[model samples]
Target: MPQSETGTDTAEPVTDHDAQAATDADTDGSSENGSVVPWTSITKPTDDTETLAAMTAASAAEPGADDMADASLPLDQVFAVLKNERRRRVLGMLKQTDDKLSLSDLAERIAALENDKPIEQLTSSERKCVYVGLYQCHLPKMDSMDVIEFNKSRGTVARAANTDAVYDYLETAAPGAEPDWYRYSTILSVGGAAALGTALLVDPMTPLPVIDGTVGCLVIVFVAYGLGAFVWTHRAD
Candidate 1:
């Protein structure tokens, strides 16, 4: 470089980048003309391919949905928690009560339903089994999702704000209101009887070509049994 007539060394030519750098340095983060400056500018969205572009576009479009990502449990997590029947029942119980529950109390209620007995009739083993499962597996998983606030120190449980998301898909019977498996057993027994009767009561009169006994007996038994079951099931109502 050579000195100019003004006695200062010849200065480098000013460029657009130099002016921009000087502008940034003067305001720190404030923009020129007193406008607000963005902390980040997307100069190269193509760096990350379409992912960054799509995300940036979405974020810019839906400013109000910023919290939507965290609004509910993720699908994989929700499905994992929902996969277990016991976990679903736990949510149902919490939704029904809508308050904190002692571990022992919760276990007793679940055990009673599981055993199809009253709370007073639940055995120690049944209660213990339910308690252990909740404590060891289910409770931890739900706590991770923050669906239930589980205080491990106090052994207490309460519904969390995010519980509603998971609870919406859950359906379960409260304690003392389980389905009657015995009724299903009756259907199985009747079907076996009907098949046995069909085998025994071979109707040679209608057995011209294809088959043996008449299906009328089977149909009659099913209709009669269905009526009886309907009556029995609705006895309380």
Candidate 2:
């Protein structure tokens, strides 16, 4: 009776014009001059650009491998240069005297020291041995480490800017000196440990039940002794 409602119902059709209008509405929000602009084109970095930026950031974060090697070179050179007795003598001579010495003078003094003779009394052979070694080998090596300035043409040598680095490794004791700082520090540490142990056993302070004064004193003594020994051993000449 109601005109067969289900079969008679009608609906609007989606035509090409309607579809185009919907598309325009969707793109218009992001369009300028009737052209859609992609957000990625403006905001996203290209692959090559991103790779370069990553590389730059990495470089800033860490030192190059060669830099690490260079930093370690000086200490290694110091040890290597000091291993030879002649080189050690050269450094000693440079350190002791304020004036720059001629290469010949340095060789003469070192030869005399080596032979246990007066410089004036050194044999030509002994002097020659020292001279050749220093001139050909030791001086150049020291110069490379910046421990000494060697002017080959002038036949002169003097302390250089980094001489202190070499001096740090040099032993400070004079020949046949009694009880060097190292030995002295060891003895002091042992004595201190013993005295603290004895005091702790005696309980002289009558420590509280929960807090042992003797044990506390012992810890303090050992810490202080260790720090003192470290300072004594590593102190500059």
Candidate 3:
């Protein structure tokens, strides 16, 4: 170097004072612009975690899953309650009303349905039959299974949480002296059997062909009718 460059000869070191000044400048710049920027910009990174934690806490504070499970009625109990016609009628009555009923009122309604008579027309023994059955047997049984609430002391009854389950199993109408379709089908079967017997009797005389085929057709019709009747009788309302 013929002549050393005076200012460039040695570079100035980055001292702590300069570094602190630069940091303070950055802090000041952030504070100045902070008012214009959204708070969301500052808080966004942790927002997801905070929201997730809040949701988790809320769910944990609710009733446990077991509580929901316990509210549902058991299938066997539903079937058991439906096995008796009186209990099914009781459920039907309760479903129609929103209020609790006295056992006497419930029995009157059930007795009317069972006897196919007006409540006023029901004989004392008829009423008593329903009353005793409900008070001592049906109501207690349903109460034990949570199908209905039976207040023994108050002599009141009301639908419980599981009452709907019983309703699901109730027949729309009582099996009712065999369905008309069933009787008609039975009559038709008898007619067909008589015809078949006549045809067999005359088969030797007339030498009719395809008697076996006719028999097969009759069998198919009978089986189909029987299956349909079974399904109709057993089907839910």
Candidate 1 lDDT, 138-221, residue by residue in tens? 998899888789998999999875687776666554544644756665776777676766666554445443123335555666
Mark the regions of model 1 whose C-alpha exceeds 4 Å error after superposition.
Answer: 1-72, 172-179, 186-237
Q: Kindly report which residue pairs in candidate 3 clash with one another.
A: none
Model 2 gets an lDDT of 0.75
- Please report the candidate that would top lDDT against the real structure: 3
Q: Write the per-residue lDDT of candidate 3 for residues 114-201, one digit (tens) a residue.
A: 6667899999999999899889998998998888999999999987766765666666564575367745776987888887887787
If both were scored by TM-score, which would come out higher, candidate 2 or candidate 3? 3
Sorted by lDDT (best first), the order is 3, 2, 1
Lowest lDDT sum, 10 consecutive residues, model 2, at 176-185
- The CA lDDT at 133 in model 2 is 91
Q: Candidate 3 at 104: error in angstroms?
A: 0.7
The count of residue-pair clashes in candidate 3 stands at 0
What clash count goes with each model?
Answer: 0, 0, 0
